[model samples]
Target: MAQPTLGIMTLYLSEHSGVEERSYFRKVIAQAEKLGLRAVVFTPVDVDAKNKRIHAYVYDTETGRWSRSWTPFPHLIYDRCRYQDSERFRKFRRFRATYTRLVYLNRPISNKWGMHQFLATSARIRPHLPHTRVYSEHADLTAFMRGRRLVYLKPINGTGGRGILRIERQSGGHYLVQGRDRNRRIVAPKLVSAKQLPLQLAAWNVKDRYLIQQGIPSKLPDGRVHDFRLLIQKNGSGEWEVTGCAGRVGPKMSITSNLHGGGQAVPMTELLRRRFASEEKIEEIRKAVYSLGYAVATEVEGRFGRLCELGIDIAIDPDGHPWLLELNPKPAREVFARIGEKETYEKAISRPLEYALWLYKQHYGTSSSRRRSGAGKSAASSTR
Candidate 1:
């Protein structure tokens, strides 16, 4: 009998075939082996459409190394490809269209504005959403900022805190602006007159590519902005559960607290304690965050199909009210390891593999019986 296989699909980051998350994929592959499942990593560019096979990267436990091999499509695919502004991403889209019958562990969710509109439809989820609008022109920004003190202009498709502008209205009719460029470099804070504000942002071309969101006040006494990242994943039983939450403190003068943009990760409890006065209030906030995480995950999976996990960015105001800021389908679990929560980090890596095994069993039965019943043949045929 053969173990069910899971394919971890990713994209090359460069023309030289540079792959992001190589170390993380290695951990996933290693854990898959321990869970009685075979795993391989591949990208759309590696697929041989005519041959109905893939050139995949496989890990050898004994040798402790990675090597390439050609193999049939696996019983399930865990898509980890993030947005890339390259030919590689186009190839991925074509691959997905061609292999529509393949069983995928997750599907892509909407972008910032689209997700905001979708989640707004839910009465249960709407209260947590901040006021947001599409940036059509300078007027849209001005109108949305009418009564707001702080507003964020974010690229709808942007990641890692790239191309984010923080605008705050100051006393005496002046505006303060700061941001991160497309490369995630901090743009120095500048103050401009109300009439000159539009020219300051003229180079951003925010008319169509950006969203104007009311920013929640997240600045600490030391002037470093912070937020929380809550990771929710489907367990072995195929139910959503909070794996762990971590607090992120942005570098000085940075508006966004993204780890990729020079932010520090802290334990959730520790960060909350620093903000909240009482243990009772901290526990209350924790429970609310968990509830919000579960509700958001359920709403997303229901709308976007089966999703194995979500990295939800949440903001807790001074009043301890939780707000939904953003969602990442392909979230990094390194925050737990960064905060030194070893157990949570291991569980974060293993839970998805366990869910994959459970899903295989649900569809194909036990490994021995699957071999006798020719379930492997069925998987290959259907997927291809």
Candidate 2:
């Protein structure tokens, strides 16, 4: 008999000290298995990228556990490894090296050291992004602040609205700036003059990378700032598709509408139509948003290989034009739950595994049929 078509899918789960991000990972694996693809989580035994050392973790269903295996290289590997400590970072780098040998689904987008790489490359993505620049030196920021009344400084590798500050020009040559608290609350508003900018910069001098952006001035009809979270996923056919839409409104004083900053999300179709639309233009606006999303995704997909999906954060100005805030290759699953009506997480989340399986089949061929025939017999049992 010919070999089975199905190949093993492996995920490298980074240990989270106290946080739990395993539920979604497990859910995706289960779905992949249900779709008749072999899937499991894995960790490398010895990871050296420049010098390739191959060590793989394989799953055993009989023992209901994962065990390390050296041979029979996996067909696909997803790097969901995170680093929260010095030791973890060391392992994370090693694990990353191992996956680089195989196709990587999504590599780290950016962090402090290299965030400007993405911003600098933003020229090619100009049509899809907001006006942004690296805020590494005081001179760069001072020049940009000239004649501009509204500005924002955000961490280059920031997630969940952390370390975001909004600055606005005020009377008497002073500026009103709003910053988030330890818990991401916008409780303290600082008033500083233009001359105090240097001091302000010194005070908030982040050793890591940061960006000073031109604020997008996004606001609802009632003057509340809000944004949209567009979920894009690749289907089994390996095409990018919008899975769901949701609106996230910033807290009363917050600049970013991230959940960590007390932002709340509502259904896109319901909120957009009910609050700011006429029957004739509802579909037009929806299509516009979707079109913009696809445009942005297509642009980034060119640079990032085999991109399975993206969580695009967008902001709509008063005139109703969507601006791409960010495109996340590895999107958090929690945001989809906010849509309230339709949960599209499975569709988006499952694409990575689907892509992996397809790629494995193309690269290494299949052993599914052989494994299945031997499942109940002695030959397969012995191989196992």
Q: Candidate 1's error at 371, in angstroms?
A: 18
**Can you write out model 1's per-residue Cα lDDT over 1-384, one digit (the tens) per residue?**
468989999988786466778999889988998889999999998888888889999988778888999999889999998987789888889988889888888887888999999999999899999999998788898899998999999989857899999999999999999999989999999999889899888966566879999999898889999999999998887778899999999999899999989999999999998888899999999999999999999888777777899999999999999999999999999889999999999999998998888667656686786665454564222221
Model 2 misplaced stretches (Cα beyond 4 Å)? 1-20, 42-73, 82-87, 107-125, 181-187, 221-224, 366-384
lDDT of each: 0.89, 0.62
Tell how far residue 311 is off in model 2, in angstroms. 1.2
List TM-scores for all candidates, in order.
Answer: 0.94, 0.76
Alpha-carbon runs more than 4 Å astray in model 1: 366-384
Cα miss at 192, model 1 (Å)?
A: 1.2
Cα-based lDDT at residue 193, candidate 2: 84
Tens digit of lDDT per residue, candidate 2, span 255-343?
77876577888777665764566755666677888987776566556544456667778876656666777666666656666654434
